[model samples]
Target: MLYFLPEPPEYAPPPRAVRVPAKLSVRVFPEVIAMSHPYELAPTRPLSFERERGITEVRFQGGLAHVEVRLPGRDVEAERLVLLQAVAEAGLPVLLIKLHPGSVSFALPDAAIAERAERLLLGRGYIYAMERDLALISICAGAMRDLSGVMAGLYDTMDKAGIRVAQTGDSHDALFALISGTNAEHSARLLRQTFGLPEGGTSC
Candidate 1:
């Protein structure tokens, strides 16, 4: 049996400066046990498991599979094979476990990185909402003269709202982390009001 240790009191580690390769351990649920167990279990040599946020992520030296599991009632075998091929190609350890609905949430240690991630998600059709600690703004290229235009736009928005921006800059394809535990709708409304965006305009 595995045991989780108590968290350190009043201690929060700073985010990693550089990206490091790590394995992601996905939980497989009991209902799907029958479906998953039938496949031959392979032990990936040198596969190392790390516990992060209550999940065991399996990491390997190099080359691992990119596994995908579909939603329930969808084709399971097809999805399993997709996952298998990804793992086999990558040469990483495989972990299959079951999980309850709404049990997973992506987390980033760095605030700036989180912001960039939100932007990527926004580009991929994930709607941007508001964040209490961080405000999301939208700037169009054609409306601006140059990089300064973008900064000026940001300043203008902040100045109009009577909100002071302590630190701001270009994330360079990174995700921004606003306030933790904020809802989608509230996040969206905040962005709209702050940036003077019209209805249905995208936010990042």
Candidate 2:
């Protein structure tokens, strides 16, 4: 059976904090931010490395532990070797499943170890991007008398488009990702139609 940790003891403080407010203002602001899509892990894939001049970059994929590294010059290889040795000495056991110019990645059997390794590498200034793909739409309009009505109208519009929604968050913002790029237009169309919004409603 698979094992799980309820909460991994905070390896480090969270990057940011959440704010709570008691009262709301009428002044409205329109802003949009992309919502990340959920992605499944492909752990068996091996890591790869690239180098140009004195710069090196490494790429590896796994659970939440996607990794990428950049180093200056041909010294990248040597630097990676030393870094791995140091981690091992710190009592952090990781298997060097792959090593290439500019980077190396470990295949850890435990999620806790993998997460710690990821944070350590990131804290060292290694460049990495999470594997999340999402499309988020935000709308701002004069305050509606009922928020529930706003949501109903939006969902009905999406429903007509024959799009299957995985999840809908409780916010004026709409977050949904298409299965394919070809469906994006359809999804956007559905979204606009639902909200009675005009094309190019949002500024670029």
Q: Give the best candidate by TM-score.
A: 2
Query: How does candidate 1 fare on TM-score?
Result: 0.22
Native-referenced Cα lDDT, model 1:
0.36
Per-prediction CA RMSD (Å): 30.7, 30.7
State the lDDT of candidate 2 residue by residue for 1-204, as single tens digits.
999869867688667976877787764324333435444322343445622221011111223222334454468767777677767765776432345566554444345766676677677776543222223333333323223465565567656766553223332232222222234456666656565556654331
lDDT for model 2 comes to 0.46
Q: How close to the true structure is residue 171 of candidate 2, measured as C-alpha lDDT?
A: 23
Off by over 4 Å in 1: 1-132, 136-148, 171-197
Tell me each candidate's TM-score. Answer: 0.22, 0.29
